[model samples]
Target: MENVEESLELHDKYQFEVKFTYPLDKTVPYTEYNVETFMFIPNNLCVNHTTYTKDDFYSDMQKYIRLKTPTMLLKNILNDDKSPLKALKEAMKTLVSEPNNELKMLDYKYHLKMFCSIFKSALRDETIFAEKLNDKEDAEDYIKSIIDSTEDIVKKFRDLKDIIHVPGLENKCYALYLFADEFVSLSLDKYRYRMIFNLDKAEVKNKKKIRSELIDLLSAEIEYRKSARYNSCPDEKSDNEELIYRESTLKKLMGSVLFLKTQTMREGIYIEQIVMGLAAGLAMAFATAVAFLSQSKLENFTFSLFMIFVIAYIFKDRMKELTRIFFHRKIQKRLYDRKTNIYNSLNQKIGFCKERFAFFKEKDIPELIKKIRNKDYITELDNGYIGEDIIYSKRFIKILSKKCKNLLDDFNVDGINDIIRFNIRNFLGKMDNPTRPLFMPIEGDIKKIKGGRVYHLNMIIKYGMINKQDIYRKFRIILSRNGIKRIKEIPLTI
Candidate 1:
């Protein structure tokens, strides 16, 4: 399962923690801070906000599988005094519903890091667009959205900055969150019965088993920490924005705008140089005409006309260059202006979004991931997970030449067939280890090498095993991340 920390924008891809922190400030210390944190229940904010635990969902899933209304079944089951599954239900409930100190800390840290992360992402998005734009309307909606989202983002960011600060603290919080999320995933995996079909579960057990164990280790860390500092002392910890990063949003935006202006300035100078060359050529042509008219002699007049022709000929390319430069610059600026307008609007939107972070509704960003469980119980209702298994399919789309077909064709002319008959298994044995390629025993695509072709069949290692005797083995292996499948061989070049 992917780490739950990635759900928040503050973390990197599959990362849970921030590299730096703001010193955590509280009335006493960590204990007095409000502990309730965000929960991950995709697309269903109501569920995320509620007190419902994973065990409750498990019971609901069982109802879903039985084709009964979950609400109705839950009501009836809760009232029942003697159900065989009741004890198991109660045990799973504690895993989710019980107060876990480590989990609480994770929730708190994520909430804080997410505020800063979202803010930076929005700002960066707007700034990148601003450079591409030259007109107003293209970025109209995008800018509006940024502005609409910014204020609420910034307000909450301030709230987070006030308390959560420590260089390495966010990393721990993210780690804790991952462990907690993974534990919950494992609980759901049990209901899915992923291990039942895997005969190799002993060697490659379900990933959830390891995730559960990790959560145990993380929980132990918090449970055994030196609580004496927070519980016994009344010292106040002060946090400030300076603890995290130095640059402000406005400063970053200014830097981007400056860079765009610099490019425009260089383009303008190049156009100016083209214009100067054209002007110099025209001036020389005019001077030659004047000199011809003043001399009046037929010979001198003819000479002056020839000189004018030479000047024009010499500047022919210059004239063309000037026209091209002027036309291109005009068209480019026109296009750039349209995009610039959009980016400016987007920039404004981001600024507005940043300023008002506190008042926005929670879950403003709609859920992108919709699977609620391993089996996605909402859509797959009444269909219990049966799991999948490794199966093979084969294909042979390519054929090798007669010379390449015989593994011993080039090497052992006298005993080529005998060599295959005696040590064919040994050649096949070499193919078993994926680190080395299966030697093609023929030349191919010689341009890649310095001289003679030393070709090796390009087979993917993780796909499956290959054998040197192509006449005996005509198919190749196809595999997914789970296990190998067989595929028919495509034609191979000699």
Candidate 2:
């Protein structure tokens, strides 16, 4: 990460750092990742020559990637009359400018999805997305042809890093069509898209103004969207009422899915209720009752024996199992109801969207943008934030595993599987921070690393170096905070 940071600082010309404000000892979302031990962790940032924290930086990157970068790429595509992105740009404009027309929305969505696919492929192999214009007649065909010509994914993002040219560094001016869709995730997941500038410091008053302006721009955009959405109601309808009515039932249910999934801190399948194993408990209870009552000759003795039996068989042990099972079932039922409702609602919404070529209403796009763009900036870059450069350590570790094919991309640098390595991980830096994996660049990077070094893998296979199967042999990777250092190489015994 430090190397990547240095590369960017010189290439992108911006200072980057990670904050340890949140205790590295505490169990954060990245607990299992052991990521803290190997990679950097950031609580804040100073990029594009401004300042930001986790939340604000994430929001800014999301808008820039989905809107700004894509829009710039469209402009790049327009330079060639036959570029597929031209169709995309036109569709995007139609989607944003027109009212809620499902047809237009579908067109834009389709184009955006294809554009992202091509963009991702380009990142893997560095195939220039803007080349070979006037070759294909249809946009999809053009994109498909590019994809078809490419070899399987090559993880190096040489062309991509050039596109997303650092928007910050205050004084740097980046070229258009340089947006690399996967680089944001590369920086963020590795905890590299961070800085040490505190917006409250008094020395950075000038830089603070720029940061504040961008933050204010984000905030204002959000507030504007809220107002627009609120004011978009037709005659006789209030904004609040209309807004609620506009959201499909599926959206509400899906929103509830988030609530249900995390309601418990348990590892997986949050057994809200246990629904199995009850007949045996009941049988044991009945058998014990009958046996205790069968001895009637000595009333006191029978009662004592019965009490002992009940305590030993039912109350002491079986009852706990019985109670747990019953309660688990109850929770299971509750969760089942909510989950079923979400799925059913989702199906219904999908049906509706399918029935007609539906998309966000035209009025809704700006409002949505306003709402998405607008957000509160917790740490403001005020005039007080002026000072000398602040330096912070950034940890970067490299891992290479063959049988553990998924380790790097599917897992973590610290050897923790991704299931436990929480914290919003994505090549996309994901929009809205749902902590999901929409764009996975880690796996691609792993594929690109050859002979313990990060880069393309052309020589290893076609050039007759190591066999493709030899790449997956097992080995021990000694871990460190300074970075991953080769301790001892253990060849696969098997």
* Best-matching candidate per TM-score: 2
RMSD of candidates 1 onward, in order? 32.3, 24.2
Q: Give the Cα-based TM-score of candidate 2 against the true structure.
A: 0.27
Output the number of the lDDT-best candidate.
2
Models 1 onward score TM values of 0.16, 0.27
Candidate 2, 1-494: lDDT as tens digits: 11111100011111122211111111222211011111111112122123323333233221000101111232233244544355555664565555367777555544544444334333333223322233323322433333333211212222333322343312211211212222212221111111112223213324444345434533443364355343222344445654335333322322221121111112114443223245455556665665656555445655677666665565536565666677665553333111111012113210000000011222433332323222224212321233111111112111222322222121112221111111212211211222223333594553332233211000000000122111211122222222223323333333
Worst 10 residues of 1 by lDDT: 350-359
The digit string of per-residue lDDT tens for model 1 on 1-494 reads 11001011112211121111111111221111001111211221122213333233222211000000011121222233422123223322332343355655533433322222223333444534533454445433433343333333323322332232234344554343333322222222221232222212323233355335434533433342223121211113734343122223322322231111101112234545666666556655655665565456545546666775666556654656666566655644322110111012113210000000011122332232111112235323322232211111121111111222222121111110000000111112212232333333345532332222111111211111122211211223232222232333434232
**lDDT, candidates in the order shown:** 0.27, 0.28
